[model samples]
Target: MIILGAVLLIAGFFLGITLLTTAGFVVLIIGAVLMLMGRSGRSVGGRRHYY
Candidate 1:
């Protein structure tokens, strides 16, 4: 997810789309948070408890 967000962010920057860049940044933050929470053994909701 972070990788995808980074890619989108780069693309947005090149395309000069301010909104896309902002959205990409938001996605990147969300992905990082999710990754950290998963590593900490916290479930994002569901019983699987796996990324």
Candidate 2:
């Protein structure tokens, strides 16, 4: 998730696509949040715990 977000972010900047840029920012924030949640050993989106 984090890797994909980073890729989208970079692609957005280089491609100069406004929509991609917005989507990338959103994805990046979500990834960061998920990463934090996972690191804290919390479950997100389902019963399976993040790890």
Candidate 3:
């Protein structure tokens, strides 16, 4: 998710697409939150890992 977000962000920026940039930022934030929760031994969506 993070990687995808980054790619989208870069692509959006280069292509001048506002929607993709916004979506990418949101996705990146969500992925980071999930990863942090997993590392803290928390379950996300009933799974130990979000991946």
**Candidate 2 colliding pairs, count:** 0
Q: Tens digit of lDDT per residue, candidate 1, span 1-51?
A: 798789889989999999889888998998898888877887776633435
Question: What 10-residue stretch in candidate 2 is worst by lDDT?
Answer: 42-51
Better of 1 and 2 by TM-score: 1
Which segments of model 1 are wrong by more than 4 Å?
A: 47-50
Give the per-residue Cα lDDT of candidate 3 at 36.
96
Minimum summed lDDT over a 10-residue window in model 3 is located at 1-10
Report the alpha-carbon TM-score of model 1 versus the true structure. 0.83
TM values, all candidates: 0.83, 0.76, 0.92
Count of steric clashes across candidates, in order: 0, 0, 0
Clash count in backbone of candidate 1: 0
Encode model 3's per-residue lDDT on 1-47: one tens digit a residue. 88888998999999999999999999899899999999899999999
